[model samples]
Target: MPSPTAFQPVATAMPDNVRILSFEVGHGECTLVEFISERQVAFRCLLDAGRVLPAALLDHLKSNPRPESPDLDVVVLSHVDNDHQGGLPGLLEAGISFREYLSPCLPAFKRLRWLFGERVNRAVDRAFAFEQQLRSHKVAVQYPLEGFKSRYASSRVTLSIISPAARLIKTLASGSPERVSALVSNSPTPLQWLFEVDEPVNEDSQALAAVFDGRVTVCPEDFDTFLPGPPGPPASSLAQQHSQGDPDFFGNATLNDTSLIVVLDILLDGVHRKRLLFPGDQENWTYVAAQHPAGLGIDVMKAPHHGGRVYLRDKDEDLPGVYAWLRPKTVIVSANGQYDLPRASFRDVLRTVGGSLLCAHQRTFEALSAGAMKQPTATSCFQSMGCDRGRGRSVTVTLTADSESADLPACVQGSGITGLAPIVVLRQDVTVPSEGLLRYTYGELDRHATWIKDRLDEARREFLNKLKKTRTAFDAITEQPLTSWRVLAALAKADGRHDLVADPDPVLKFARSQHVFWCAPVTGYRASPESFASLPAAADFNAARRWLKSIPSLLLIVESGNRFPTGTARVEILQHADWGVFDHLLAGKLKHPAPVIADEVRPVLLPLIAADYSFRLCHFNYPDSHYDGGKAFLLLQRDSVVIPDLLSPEWQVAWDWHAHGSPFKAPWKILAKLASEQMLAGTYLQTPYGRDALFNRFKPSTTTPLPAAMHKARWVTY
Candidate 1:
C-alpha cells in the first residue's frame, strides 16, 4: 500500500490557531490544532491552531476574501517544506494580501538558481514580481516584517524570534576558515532539511517557526546529532576547549550551529501554553547554555538529530536540558525511511529527560505491510500508545473430533464470538468465508486440529448457503396427511445444530407459522392415553382446537402396563416353583386373568401402532444391561413415549446416547444402524455432560455395509 504523506491541512486557521492534518502508515489521517487558554497548558501542550473557518479546504486558502472582510493581518509561513508550503504560491498569486509576515531568508536555493540563474537575486526578484502584481490594483507596497510591523499598531501579528542570535552569527562569521567552511558544509541543505521535498533544490526554503496559539512547534527535519566536533579531536582537547568557555571561539561545532532553534509560547483567552520546540538544521548544544541560562522545558519536543547523542552535556553524561527541562510526552522521529536511535546516550536522555518516544521506522512499516497496522505519519505516534489485545477471551462455539477437537479457531481465542459466531472452518464444510473477513483457528492447537476443523466448518456453511438456493429432490410423500410427528421432526432438524443450519431465520419462519392460530396448549400440556383403561383428556386450547383438524373418534392409545406375578408378602421371594395358587390369585384376584402386557417374543408398541395416523412416537429399546438397573428405554422425539424410569435423576443422567431406534426391521432403525457403522471408524461418544469425548470404533458384522441410496438418509436426533 502507498504510504500517506507526513503533512496535510486539517482546516483553515483563524485569529488564534491553525489546524494541521497528517497521515501515518498504519493509521489514517488525523487533524489537530491549537487551543488558546490561560493555564500553562502544562505537560499536555498540543499544537493549537486557530478556529476552522468556513471554506472548502483547497479553495479557501488560495482565494481572496470578499471586500467586507478585506484581507488578513498576517500570512505566517510556518516552515519552507512542500508539506507546509504547498498552497502558499497560489495564495500569494491571488489578491489575498497580508499586512505583515515572517519567513527565513534563503541564501542559495537550488531550484531558483536552476530556474532564474545565480546572477539575479531570487528573493528580491520574487518580491519585485509580487510588488508589480499589487501595483496593477494601484496598491502601495509594504515590506511585512521590518517597516510595516513597527509602524502598524493595529496589526496583532508579532514574531518573537528564538533562533539565530546575532551574537553567535558574529562569532561564526569571524571563525577560522576551517571552522566556517565546516559549519557551512555540515549545515542541512534545503533538500536534506525535509523528508518529502517534491521539487528538489528548494532555493525558496524558508525554515520559519510553526505556531500553535502564537507558540512555536519544532519540526526537526532530518537533523542528526551524531556529527562530532572536529572529527579527529581527542576527549582531552574538547574538555580543554570547553573549560575556557569564551563566546568568540566556542570551538568544535559547525557554522550551521548559528541556525535558529525556536520554541513558541502562545497566550489567548487566559490560556497560556508552551507548545513545541522546532530545532532547525542546527546541531549546537553549548550555544543555548551560554546564550540562555535556563533549561528549556516544552510540551511536545521533536527529537534533536533523530535521537542522536550529539545533544549531550559537556561531559556527555548529563543530558543537558532533558530531565530538568523538557516535558515531552511525544518525541517524534519523522524520518522518511528506517533508522534505530542507538541504545546508549540517546536512551539516557529518553529515560532521564525526553520521556516516551515514537518513530516512523522499520517495525512500523512492517506492521503496515502485514495488514496489522497503518502506515507512517505524524498522527500514528499519538494513536499507537498501547499494544492491542485483539479478540481477548469470550468465544462460545466448540468443535469436537475423535482424539481431537479443533472447533475453536486460534484467531478467535482472545476475541468475543457472541457476534454471530463464525462458522468454524472445515474442508467438508458447506462453504469458505470470503478473504475480506477475519478467520479463526482455535481447536486442538497442538495437533493443529483446530485449523483443519474451522476451515471445514467455514467451507460447509459456504456450500450449504448455496445448496439452499438450489433445491434438491427426493422420494415424494403427499404434502397433505401432515402429522404433528412430521412437523416436530422437521422443526428438530432445522433448529438442532447437529444439522448445521447456517441460516436460522428462514427455517424458524416456517416453524413459527405452524402456530397459525398461535394458541398455547393447555398450560404445558401432557396427554396420557390408555388402551385398556381410561384415557387422559386433551388439555389446552391448541390441543382442543387440533381436534377440529383430526379424523373424528381416532382412538389414540397407550401400551398395556407390565404386571409381574406376585408371591406371599416377604422381603425376598423364591422362584416360580415356590409360588402357590394363592400367589397367582392375589396377583390378579381373578379366576382367569387376561394378560395386559405382550410376551417377550417382540416388544409391542401399541401406542405407536394405534395412533390412527395423526401422530407417531419414535423410540428405542436397549436390552436390559447389568451396568445399572435395566438398560434405558428411550423416546427419541415423542411427547408420549417417555419411560417412567426417566423420572429418576440417576437414569436421566446415565442415559447418554441411549435413544430412539430399537433393533427392529423399521426403516429408521436400519438407517441408524448404517450410520452407526460408518461413523464407528473413529467416532466419539460424548456423555450427557462430558468434558471429554470417548472414542467408539464400533463396526457391524456385515461387511457390505449400507449402499449410498440408504446412506442418503437423515439421522433424526433425540
Candidate 2:
C-alpha cells in the first residue's frame, strides 16, 4: 500500500501542430487541414473540392514535399449537390489520390434512383461516375451515419459526425419519389406582386456590399415595409430588415439540410487540445444546436451557409441557443462574391458578440492584414480589434499543452485579446457495440414481438376491410339488368372490341337495323358502313371468325349477349356440335386461333351471350377500325372495365340505359365521348393495334422551344 504508490495518470503523446487552410475558391468552399508532428506534416484532410480548386491550393499541393505514399488521408464530399462536389472530379483528374472518401450519397445509389426516378438522370449519373472513379482508384468509400467517429493521424486527431440524424436519411430513402422530388424542388414562396416594391437606395449600400464580399447590395427600403409596428429592445432596424427577407434568402433548404456536420478534436500537445466545427452547409442550425448544446465551445467555427443572414439576423442578440453553446473564438466564412453571401448584417452581429470574423478571400485577407502591427486610429473601425489575417487568406491558431492561452498568428491576434485562453475540449469515446455485443433482455425481445404482432394485426384488418368493399361493389354491379344489343355494341367499341363491331355478319346487320335511330346520339360511335361496302363475298370470313374466337372473355360476353338472347335458343346454339371447336375460346383459354367456320358462325356467337351477367350496351363507332361498319353495337360488362371518371354526365346516362334500345343520337357524339374518356384516362383502350391507336387518338400538341432571350429570362426568374 504504497501510500507510496499514489495513482498516476498516464501521459499521452500529442501532435506538435494543427493547421487549417480555407481556400479562396470563388463562391464555393474548400478547406484543407494538416496535422504536423516533429515539424513535418503527418496527415492531410481535404473537406470539399468546392466548385473549382483554386490555382494557389493546387500549386501548393503540387510543390509541397510528400512522403513516399503521398495520399490525402480523407476527402469528404459532404453531400451530392454540385457546389460541394463539383471540383472533386477535377481534383481526382489532377492525380490527387485519397485514402478515404466520405459522402452521404456514395452508398445511396438505390435511394437516389428512387428519389429521382428518371427525371434527374444526369445528376445521378455523375454521382455514380464519381463513385466508380473512387473505386477504380482504390479509395475506401463510406457513407457516414450520425454519431460515427474515427481517429486519424495516429490518433492525435478525432472526427465525429454530428449530422444528419439517422431518422432523416431513412425518411429520404423510404419516402415516395414524388415526395422526395417535391422536397428537392422546395423554394421560397413567390412574393406577391402587391408586396413587391422597387429596390431601395442607401448611401452605405455599396460599401456594405463590398464588405460582404460584393455578393449583394443592401436595400433598406426593400425590407422596411415588413417591420413590425414598434421594434422591441433587442430588435434593431438591422434585425427587422434582415427578417424581412425569405428564410431561404441565402440558399435552398434541400441540399443544405443534408450537409455533413462534423466536430474535430485535435490534441495539440498531450494536455492541450483544440476543437473545430465544420458544419458543411447545414441550414438547420437549431437541430445542431439542440443536439450539441453543452461542452461544444470551440476555438474555431466555419460559419454555416456561407455566413448567410438566415443563421444570424439580429445584430443586438445572438441566435437562440446557438451562440451561448458554441462561444466560438473565431468564425470563418468560405464564400466569395456570389449570390450575396457573407452577409454584412451577420458580420455585424458576429462583431457585436465579440467574436473575430474572417473571410476566405484575397481582398478580405489583404484588408485584415493591411496594417497588422499598427494601432487603431479614428479612420480604422477594424483596427480597434487586433486583427491578424493569417498569411495567404489562411488563418492558423496553435495551442501548447502547458500554455494557458492559444498561440495564434500576429494577423489573427486582435488588440483586446493578445492570446486566447484554452477552451474546454470535450471528448466522447463512443464504443460502438458490435452485432455480437448487442444483448437484448427477454423483456425487450417480448416487447418487440408484441409490437410486430400488433402491426401485423392492424395490416390484416385493413386488408380485410378493402376486400369486403371490393366484393360489395362487384355484387352490386352484377345484379343490374343485361344490357341491350345496341348498348352492348357501343360498350364493346368503348372497351376495345373494334373487330367485333367490324364484323359484317347477319346478326350484326339485324342488331344495327333494329337500332338505326338508337345509334345516332351515341358519342364515339361510328357506323363502319365502308367496311361492309368494301368487303368482297370471298373476303376472309374464316379470318373474321378466327378473330371473333380470339376475343377476351369480357368482349366475348358482350358479343354473345348482343348476338343471342338469354334463352334455350342461345344454350342450344352454344351446345351445338359445330360450336365445340370454339368452347375453349369462350372460356378465355384459347392460345392459338382455331380454323373459322364459314357457315356455322351463329354457333360461335352463342357462347358470348349465354352467360348470365349484367351488361351495358351502346351504339358507337370505332374510328380507327379497319372494317368500317357505319354503326356498330358495343357491349360493356358493368364490372369488368374501369370507366373514365371524367366522362360526361350524358355518357353515364347512356351507360345506365335500360330502354332495351340505343340511347345515342349522333355519330360525332360517339367520337366526342370516346375522345374525352381517353384523354381523361391518359391511355387508349386496349386493341389489336396496341397503344398506337391511343397515341394517334390523343397525341399531345407540339410545343415550340422558347427563344434564347425568353428562356434566359424564365430561368433567371426561377
Candidate 3:
C-alpha cells in the first residue's frame, strides 16, 4: 500500500439508474441518458438529425455498454445551438435509437429544426437511426405532452418542465433590459427554486427537472443571465409574426428567459420519493422559492450559465450571491474553464450555497480549492476524463436509481480511514490459492497426480474446520417484534444458514416473505457478476438480496465523505438498516417516508451519522499547490455550528506544506496515517489518536461534553 494523499484518485462508477455519458467535442459535448428496463436503452434527448454526436461520447457509449439490451426513451434538444447538438446525427451512425424528441419548442430554434421537417427527413432518407427505429418498434414521439411517468426494472424516473411560463414570457418581451435586470436582480440563486416575482430569462429557458430513484436533480441550462450581443436590430416583419403580445424580444421574451421550470415529488407505494427542480434559465424562480417544495433541496445542480455573474444582482456580492437556492450537494458548472464565472463571483456563490462547487476546466484557481471541490480527487472513473473540460454550452447530467447513494468508490484509497478492528468476516472468508501445482505438467495429470491429491486433501480439511462452528450463527425467526423475547428464544433453535456464503436463494426467500420489492441495479452500476472481479456470481433478484445481506460486512465505518466539496463529516455505519433504504439515506434525498426496512427477522441496520469533527482538528494549512494562501478549517460537519478560534490559534493547511511546497509534507503522511487509523476504528475505539487532545480541550459532544470557558477581554468597537 502507498501513502495516502489528497491527490490520490478514488474510483467512482456510474449509478445504477441512468448514467450520464458525455463525450468531448470541438467546443461542446453531448450527453445521453439510459434507462434500465426490460432492456438497456438510451434516452435520446439530443440528435443531430444527420450530423455527428461528439466522437468521444459515442465511442465510450459503444464500448461501455449496458447489460440488457437498452432502448432509447426520450430525446432532448436543449435549444438548437450547433455545439450543443452537433452529435445528434451520430446516434444514427452509432445504430442507436430512441422514441421521444424533447425539443425546446422555441421559435428561434424551431427554424433550424424545420430543416429536418417532414420533407427534409424524407429526403435524407437513408433510414435515420432514432426516429426510424422508433417507428419500426411501434414507438414514436409524434408530439410533446405534459410529462412521462417512466419506470424500468423498479427504478422510477420522471422529467418535469418548469420554464417558459406564459406570464414571464409576456413580461420579458414587453420590458427594457434594465427592467428585466431589476426583476432578475433580486431573484434567489437556484432560480428554479426561488419564487415571488418573475425574472425574464428564468421564465423562458426550458428548465427540465429529473427524478431518479428518489433523488431530485434539476439542470437549469443558463438560468443566470449575461445578455450577449448588443440589442440585435429589431426583428423584421416575418420574425415579428407572433409579436402581437410583446415587441422587443429581449425586452418581452429574451430567449434565455423562456426556460421551463419544475420540481418533482417522487414516491412509490405512497412513500414520498426524492425531489429535483429544473429551471431552464428562468430569470427568476416564480413557483419554487415561494413553495420551498421538497424537491427544491436538489442534490445535484448545474450552474446557471456556468455561474455567469450577470444572473446575480451587483448587490448579492455585498450579501450572499447566486448560489443560494440551487445549493446542490454537487454543483457541476459547465463552462469554458478559461472563461466565465469570474473569480469574485465564484467565491460569492461558494459563501452563498456553502456546498461543493465543481467548476469546469479549472477555469478559476478557486475551482481547485477545498471550499469548492474539496473531496479527494476522483480520476479513475471512466467519466472524469475531460469532465472538467466542459465544452461551450455543452454539459450533460444523468440521474439513475440503481444503488442511489453515489456508488461507494470501487476502491477508497485516500479516505483517511482503513484497517479497523480485525474484520471477522474477512478473516473467515478470505482464501489464498496455491500456485499451479496441478496433476498435469508435461501431460500434467499423471505427472503431478500425487501432489494434486495432497493439496486437495489439505484444502478440504481447512474448509471443514472453518465451517465447524456451532457457538454463534443465524437462524429463522418464528416470532414478531424482533427485539422481544419470543423471537430471541427461537433464534437459537433455528439452523445457521450455511448457503448464505454464496447462494442468494436463502436471501430471496426471506425478501419475498416480507413483500418487499427487490429493486436492484439493472444496467448502469454493473450489477451483473460479469462486471465484478470475475466473481461469476449469478445476477438476479436472489443475487441482489444476497449482496444486500453482505453489506454490513463490506461497508467501511468512517465518517461518510461526499463527491461534493465540503469538509463536513458525513459519517455512516453501513451495518445499520438504513443502508438498503435506497436514496432515502442520502442527505439530499427528499423527506419521503423511508422505504420499509429489509426483513425484520434477519434485520440489518445501516445508520449514517453526520457529525462535526472540526472540534477535534480545529486547524488548517494552505495547500502546497496554492502555497502561501492561509488555511482556515475548510470543513464543518452538517448541523454543526463552528465557533471561530476554538483552538489556540488560527490554523493553516498542513504546516509542512506552508513551509515547503510539496516535498515537506513528510510529517503530513504520519499525521494522515494517525487520522486514518482513528477514523477506521469509528467511535468505538479505546485510546483513540486525536480524541484524547479534543476530549481534554473543548470536551464537546452530543451529551456531556463541556461548558464554555469564561474569559475577560476588553471589547473594542473599532
Candidate 4:
C-alpha cells in the first residue's frame, strides 16, 4: 500500500506559525492549536474536545508508534458544560498521552454541589472519575489560576493562565465542603426544591494565553460568571415548576455571562502585528468594556457563546456593541444550529458593524439565514477532508520577522453551481410545522465522490508507472491495469475494514454529509481525505438509502405553459431545482404581468402556476406576525439603468421606513406611499454587489410608447 503522504496533499510549511483549528462537533466546540518551528510541529494543545473528539486527532494518534508517544502537551476543559467536556472520556479511551490537563479546580466543583442542590451530582462525579483516570495514566492535572505560567516542548513557547482568578478560588473554597443532599419523599404530589439565590459557576472556567515565537493568542473559556448577583430573580417560578423536566434549567440563563475573555496579541520582536480575541460565550460586554476601558482594537474575534444574544450596549455609559468598540475586521463563529444559534440578529449586528463573518460550518448559518445572506467560505476542515475523516475549521496564521499572514482554505474545489437553496421538510415527530420542520439537503456528496475517484486514479497511475522489478506479494496478488474498484478493495484490506469493499459508496456518502447543514457550497479551505473508511463499519445499503431519504426532494413541477421560463410552459419541469431556478425564471419568458407577491410563498408557488392562474398561494402560508416582509419591484428600463451606475456612490439608495410608518395607513395623503413598500428586484442584473440585500426604492411609472415601429416586449418574474 502507498504511504499516507503519497496520497495526501503536502502543504508548504512556514518557519514560525500558529495554526488554530476549530472542529464541527455538532452543537459543541473542539479547537486545536499547533506551534510550528522550522517547518516542524514543536508543540500542540487543545482548548476543548467538544462532545465527540474530532476524528482528525484520533486518526493521527492511531498512526503514531505507541500509546507512550505523547500526542499533545496540554488539554484544557473550558467548563463542566456537557457540550464542552463530554468528549474527554473518549479521548482518554483512545490511549492518547498528554503532559498536562487544565480545567476548573476540584474545590469549585465541590462548592457547586451546595449551590445547585443535587442537580450537579452526576456532573461532579463524572469530573472526579475523569480526574482519577488521568492520574492512573500518570498525566499531571492542573487547575488554571490567574498568572500561572508554564513552558514546554521548547523554551520559546509559553502558556500563561489568565482567568479563574485567585480571588474567585478563595470565594469558592470559603464555603463548606459538606452540604445536605436532597432526599426523595413519597406523597400524593411530587416534592420540589426552591432556592432564594444562585451563584454563577461558569467564571471558574479556564482561560489562558499562549505565546509562541513572541506571538500570543488568548483563550477566555466561558467567563460568564460575575461575582455580584444579577438584578432579576435568581431562578424563575416557571423554572421551579418545570425544573424536573430540564436538566440545566437553573444554570442556562447566567452561564454565558461566566465566560472568561481571552486576548491574543501577535507580535514579532515586541512589534505588534495583530490581535485576536476568543471570548468563549461571554454575553455581558459591559464587563469586557470595564476590563478594557481604552477599548480592544482586535483584528479578529470568535463570536462569544456561539453568537447567542449578548448585552452589547451600556445605556448609562453610552457605549457601543463590543464588535463596534473593538472594531474587529473579521468575526468567526463556532456553532452548528443547536438552539437556533448563531442567531440571525447576531449576524445582522456583525454586518451592521462592518465585520466580515466566517463560520466554522457555513451551511449551518446558510440554513439559519434563509437566503437573507450567504456565508462565503467553507472554512471548516470537515469541508475539505469529508466529514467522514476530517473535522472543523483550520485557520492558520504565520508570523515571521518580515511578514504575517492568515489563510483558511478547503482542500477540495467548491461547487460551481449558484443559488442552490435548502428546502425544509416536516418530520413525523414534529407537531408545530413552522418551528419543528427540519432543513435537509445533499451536502457536498457529489464533490466528495469525485474527490475519492481522483485519489484512486492517482494511486493507480503511480503504481503502474513504477520501474520494472521483482513483484512482491502485494504486486503479484493484484491484477494489471488496476481499476478503481480494485483500488478500493486494496484500501479496505489495508485499513482492516473488509466490509467497505462490499459497499463503499453508501458508507462514504452517508458519512461525508454529516456536519454540513445546507444544500449549497461553502468556499475556502484546502485539504484532502487523510484516510479511507476511517469510521467503524456502517449499516447496510438499504439502511443508508433510508437515511438519505430524509433529505427533501428538489424536483419541482412547472405550471402554466406560457408562464414558465422556457416559454414551453407545462413541458418544462425542474428536477433537483436549486435557488438558481430564480435566475432562469427571471431570464425566461413570462406570459402575463407579474403580480405583487409575498416572499414567504416563493417555494409554495413552485408546484402551481401551470395548475391555475387564479390560485392564491398565500392560503398555504401562516398569517404574518409582523410587517417584516418588504416588497421587491422588477422594473424594466433600457440601457439607462446599468449595473455600475447603480453601484456608484452618487446613486446610493437608502430607505427610512421609520420616518413614514404604515404605507397603506396614508396611501392617498402621501404620494411616496404608492411605491414606498417596493424594492428593486433587478432581474437582469448579475453582480457580486448588492447580493446581501435588495435595494428598497420607489417604483417608477412608464410613459407612452412613441418609438417608430415599436415591437411588443416580453416580461419576466422577479
* Whole-model lDDT per candidate: 0.28, 0.45, 0.32, 0.41
Better of 2 and 3 by TM-score: 2
Q: What global local distance difference test value does model 3 have?
A: 0.32
Model 4: per-residue lDDT, tens digit, 288-380? 443344456766566676766555332121112455555666666667656666664554455445566555543322233333333334333
lDDT at position 704, candidate 3? 41
Find the 10 residues in a row with the least total lDDT in model 4.
Answer: 183-192
Give the Cα RMSD of candidate 1: 34.8
- CA error at residue 443 for candidate 1, angstroms: 67
TM-score for all models, in order of appearance: 0.28, 0.42, 0.35, 0.41
**Which portions of model 1 show Cα errors greater than 4 Å?**
1-90, 93-97, 107-158, 170-179, 185-258, 271-273, 301-324, 329-333, 338-718
Clashes of each: 70, 48, 85, 28
Task: Report residue 339 deviation for candidate 4 (angstroms).
Answer: 0.9
> Can you write out model 1's per-residue Cα lDDT over 125-240, one digit (the tens) per residue?
44334334444644433211111112121222123445544322322323233433333333121111111111111122212211111223221121112111222333234334
Those runs of model 2 whose alpha carbons end farther than 4 Å from true positions after fitting are: 1-15, 106-125, 177-252, 310-321, 362-718
Q: Model 2: how far is 361 from its true place, Å?
A: 3.8
Estimate the Cα RMSD of every predicted model relative to the unseen true structure. Answer: 34.8, 26.5, 30.3, 29.8
